[model samples]
Target: MWDDVFPIDQVQEIRTKTTVYLGAGAIKKIYDIAKDLKEKGVDNVLVVTGRSSYKKTGAWDHVEKALKEQGMGYAVYDKVTPNPTADSVDEATKMGKDLGANAVIAIGGGSPIDAAKSVAILLEYKDKTARDLYELSFVPQRAVPLVAINLTHGTGTEVDRFAVVSIPEKEYKPAIAYDCIYPMYSIDDPELMTGLSLDQTKYVSIDALNHVIEACTTKTANPFSILLAKETVRLIAKYLPKAVENPQDLRARYFLLYASMIAGVSFDNGLLHFTHALEHPLSAIKPELAHGLGLAMIVPAVVEAIYPASKDILDEVLEPITKGAEGAEEVAKTLEKWIFSVGVTSKLEDEGFKGEDIPKLVKLVRETPSLDGLVSLAPVEGTDEVIKKIYQRSLKPIA
Candidate 1:
């Protein structure tokens, strides 16, 4: 087993660029937030979001009303897809530039908010392409100020500078991590999540759960991350089932949203391992598959594969996740069972991937230059062949 390979000589500190406001109707704080930005000379703003849901959920109306009341000029870029692409970021940047947007406000889930982050940065880099952003060839000194009013409890994109942007043509999705892309602030109102379907709540909650599990299990796990991960795991294990069973449970939704932010901070600091690396290619190839479901499908397989190396840490975290389950294998089984109970049961085969797709996914993992950093963080050796075998294991039904 590889010992924790991170720099132990350097002390790890917890920090965040985004300040969070949380409550039942916390989204209403956007009105004052917009006014403050306007006072600070952010006159024209870009509102990045998805279609129909924002309107259907009344979030867009709320934001529109705020902008109108504040007399702030705003343009809406609402074409953000589930797995947002570099092309979409470029298009949104073009719109923000055309509208002379000096600030960005994002509503909806991770995709739109993440797109907003890239768009804000790209607005300043008129000469650079989204491809340059994805390739890390250029780093903007700053992004236009961003404010996120989260509509989903998942992604936690509102609180972090990282954005997962897809190069769909190449069948790759890599995170765009830069210092300046963090939001100026975030408003996480559990009320917004009330309209979510049970499936939506379950899948997104699972994504947050994975963030905690991945961060706690990574080589960089420290005092801060360990605390956050344990608390996040316990909260999700207790509240996610309740949220999934009763989508209108305000208590459940609130805690799940809290856990999402906690897990986001944990992973943002500790970084993730093979779970994200393995899950990325699946979604990149099948854009229709929900990101959380893709993570759900392969998480147990990767955990089981890495058990030999991660057992001690897995044992420590297993009780919080399993309540009483012990040992690495039992923890994995319990995790998978909990995932099944929560309603995500799709396998790679069920998602339309065949035996041939395994090699394709393996190749994508092997070829993704940026993935090497994340791949190297896995507790177990993640050789191309080992990654290929994990993908093979995922071909069977998860249940």
Candidate 2:
């Protein structure tokens, strides 16, 4: 138990090595870059795009046409899925090897981007097990270059070097990050997301908000991270609702994407907290509840759990979202209200989680590595009571 909150000014030693290509129609940049690659004699491009999105945008066909127009050789790898499993990785890796792809371009949401990154890493270390990659303790000495074309809101998954992978057979879920995982190109195209469902937009948008909140209030507090987190929360609060309410609202959609992009930058350093830690088990246990919704449901309570250490950060996180709530308590209270406003119908009971699973979930929490990283500076004891309290309080309906 920390007697006081952690003081933070600088978050991480951030030196951006990855190049970002941004525009309303960012995918075109891929065509331009591909042409440039050909000029430089780098051509074996593998296009890893979401199966659904590739069909929708005809992006695979578009990329193929673009490459063929330049007499460039490229392969389309369409084996992408949400919440990727090891089997998905194995399949994707085979595609990369068979094509002899020298570079990769992952199009569409976090799923395809993550899958493409995994495939690139796997190609270089064909001998390494999937387990080694997920652990991220070590990586192959060789890795192929990769680029990402991001769609959808939140997730900032395009910019980060981490990927959340699932093990359905063993019921394990781990977030893997490595220097090798960073995209050589992170291309943000706002128009590409105008087709997203309201639910998809809402969930992803909220996930970005949670990143800022957790990053700001966690045991690790950095001044730069806090400022970025605060600005991210303010913009998301201002724009997400409008974006969800009207997909055609181009300005709203643009700002939401912009905010998520900046939040992704903060995520590159500030890291996530217990809301993410506890959420992994829940998502692994029940795929129906996306990790984002899990964060929304648990975050109110997670907010309370960290209340002792950083009520001030919590208050600041909540203030803009709440529109001038009295103070930390009210701001925190407003967060609960804001969570509901965003359409998160989070009820563990509704999800069919039995009381027996509580202890099991608690065990997952206690054993989870580096969750202590979130509470590291706070001096937490890392016990069942702490997790149990969060679970119980999170289940309560917004009052």
Candidate 3:
């Protein structure tokens, strides 16, 4: 039945590697997980996080309290930054290895979880640095177990096998995917996300939305992936605004987190396209600019450029994004309006993406491994000319 709609190679392989505990108070389940890990003879754990967001929200305290109660030894590696560097992964992996960690507890958003995933593989590699891992010169013998406690609603790193790491000196951000990097379990505790600033909420919400949007239109999208994508788009369309307007609304926060996870699962089977491919260099070069903003600036132009070739799914997505809007042009405009309504201004120039930077940005995207293949998965060819045009369009606000 599945193969009927999707070709054999394009068929999605479904697997539920992570046991997810979700909802308002789900963070408390960490205690139960710690107890189980202890019972299973897992001793040392590495608590990976970024600068003080977990500490600010007291989520780290909850994780620590649970580990302490279970008498589990652990180490902290919290130096991860947004668009986390490969060097940081190597540094954290060393700490985890030195602590003899049997497992990693990834707390916070995508950066930390992504770092944890890289660290998991690197901890087992023993002799290789993150540079070697990024270069694909070494594969891990085994991944250290991971428990993902998600504090934000983006990236879906908790449920996916992908990790995107940056090399700052070379101005490159490359993604890595290996099956073993999938977390053993995950927690989507909305309570942990209530502390997110309005911009953080808005940015990651759009990030998740892009995850579904891009995957849904990718060449590999299957029936199941599109179903998940449609629902994810609808949920984000309805809930993101409410969550952003009122951060204290746990219901909105919970559903948005749900959307993020579903999109993660959807895209795990169906890959992404030029939206992510284009956004990579933006964030890689300007690490301070949130990734979702880059997507917002670039997606309208990308959608318009690809619409002629991608119309089947692109037209089908209109009802979800715009309530039965007709035509790809209308969908792109509606998407642009919706993005603007979210308080995300869509000008790459505003983010310091200049004409001079275009060449280097395109160079970085080409230099990044596997991205060209992913970009080629788009209906439109992501040739140097096309990518340059997309970046040039992004410099102005998407109309």
Q: Give the alpha carbon lDDT tens digit for every residue of 84-194 in model 2.
A: 776787777777778777777788787788878788888888777566677555755556887777877788877787777776765667777677878876767676778
Candidate 1 per-residue C-alpha lDDT over 48-156 given as tens digits, one digit per residue, 9 for 90 to 100: 9888677877777778888888888999988999999989989889888999999999888998999898888988888987888887787688889998888888787
Q: How accurate is candidate 3 locally (lDDT)?
A: 0.83
Candidate numbers sorted by TM-score from highest down: 3, 1, 2
Candidate number with the higher TM-score (1 or 2):
1
Segments in model 1 whose C-alpha atoms lie over 4 Å from true places: 1-15, 323-327
Leading candidate by lDDT: 3
Query: What is the per-residue lDDT of model 3 for residues 1-399, given as tens digits with 9 covering 90 to 100?
Result: 331232212212234667777766777778888998898888999999998998987788889999999898999998999888988998998898889998899998999999898888877878888888776677665788899989899788888888888888877788887889888889887778888999899889899888877888888888877888887887788788898789987778877888898889888988899999989989888899888888888888787778788777766654656656556567677788888888887588888778999998888788887677778888777899999988887788655
lDDT, candidate 1, residue 19?
Answer: 78
Model 3 TM-score on a 0 to 1 scale: 0.93
**Given candidate 1, what's the lDDT at residue 192?**
83
- What's the TM-score of every candidate structure? 0.93, 0.89, 0.93
Candidate 2 runs further than 4 Å off: 1-15, 39-41, 140-142, 323-330, 366-381
Clashes of each: 0, 1, 0
